[model samples]
Target: MQLANKTIVVTGAGGGIGRELCLQLVQRGANVAGVDINLATLDETGRLAGVGRDRFAGFQLDITDGEKVSSLPAEVLAHFGVVDGLINNAGIIQPFKLVNDLSMDAINRVMAVNFYGTLYLTKAFLPHLLERPEAHIANVSSMGGFLPVPGQTVYGAAKAAVKLLTEGLYAELKDTNVKVTVIFPGAIATNIMQNSGLDVPNADAGSDSQFKTLSARQAADQMLAGIEKNQFRVVIGQDARAMDKLYRLNPKYAADLIQKKMRSLLR
Candidate 1:
């Protein structure tokens, strides 16, 4: 979709792929309402955007708050007078642990942000999106969404829901002006680990998976192109692409192999 003059709301706009997507959207002539819970990080994103104030704005929001999420479309419409796109990019991976070891609070928090947050935002914006000739909804799923990554079962489950949700939305929205695209990204060097209060793995000493990591900017670029072409699925990073292919070829074998290979990484 043409981004010029379009108003797009990007959740989790403070870090990683979200931040990169925000900058690229502005560069492509889109007016952006960047939303995140971290006010300081949001400020950094705005500063890095370097676009004039008129072209971009930032808001601090906890995406899981249904009331705030429901109110966002109206607020953005008030600011930009129209809404053309929504990017459900806000997500969290909390307290990496086995399911039995995971606390309910951590699992709930992850589900709230990654699943309900995306659902709330999408439902809130669908009506406004339907008003436009063409609109787009881009959801950030994960490589774990398709295959259970050992360390984060709850996170994988939430993202898996997002993947299905996006696909279902696409099926339902077909023959309409709105488009839905889901992204599965492999490891990108992001602050998600620190933000989740987990030790960031030593990239240099880790397995070859470390070498295959993509930059946040690279993933964001691929996402933009996928949305532009209305692709149903976009896999980012080499690891994600390979895993996706492997799963497509043999789901059970891939799952079992991953379970055996990453048994140690779960901790």
Candidate 2:
């Protein structure tokens, strides 16, 4: 799944890791169709990529809308002429509140964006990917998917669903031309809170020592590398890698450890 000259579609291309992925993919000689709800920011992504219209196209669309998502592949093909890969990267976090204190609307919104949005785009683009000689699909699940954070219960659940959905796709597509890769990312330095319409908190306000977070560019690099190698699972950042191992060895301990550290951050 070499990226050179390939056409890849990436959601959440307006900001954070998604924007970084678009930039790096263009550097690898891939034609990128960057999708985001924010048209202005998506254009900014294209500007940062420094690629002309021939190499990059930005589409403004809400991924949670099935009709819009289903229409994306054709639009991408019309712009790039072919599709080689799809990256489901758009997602949102829950309000920093306990599940019992959270509204059902908030919980459902998280699930819609984090889980259903990924599913819709994957389903829409999967057939096109299978048509290619060697195609790949990468979905970004969070470290919260594997380790429970007290304040982000529903967000974690949504990502965990994505994790399983990606793994299951890998199993089903094992004999097909399409390759599947699921990513688990630790905290990354990004404006996700702002993007999700939430306020930012002081980094040192909580009792837990601030964990080392990966940069958006670093996470994007790791994701592309994983897709290139046709890897089954890619965990970004040292914190995520450590938790992956810990969760495997002792899920209870891993959950408790995160709860101890993050509970103070919960409202």
Pick the TM-score winner.
Answer: 2
lDDT of 2 by residue, 1-267 (tens): 999999999999999999999999999999999999999999999999997999999999998899988998888888888999999999999888898999999998899999999999999999988899999999999999988888889999999999999999999999999999999999788889988888776443333445577799999999999999999999998888988999999999998888777745763
The best candidate in terms of lDDT: 2
TM-score of each: 0.95, 0.97
What is the lDDT for 191 in model 1? Answer: 82
lDDT of 1 at 172: 98
In candidate 2, which residue pairs clash? Answer: none
The lDDT, on a scale of 0 to 1, for candidate 2 is 0.91
**Candidate 1 per-residue C-alpha lDDT over 58-176 given as tens digits, one digit per residue, 9 for 90 to 100:** 98888899998888887788878988999999888967578889889899999999999999999999999999989999999999999976768899999999999999999999989
Candidate 1, 149: how far from true, in Å?
1.3
- Poorest lDDT segment (10 consecutive residues) of candidate 2: 202-211
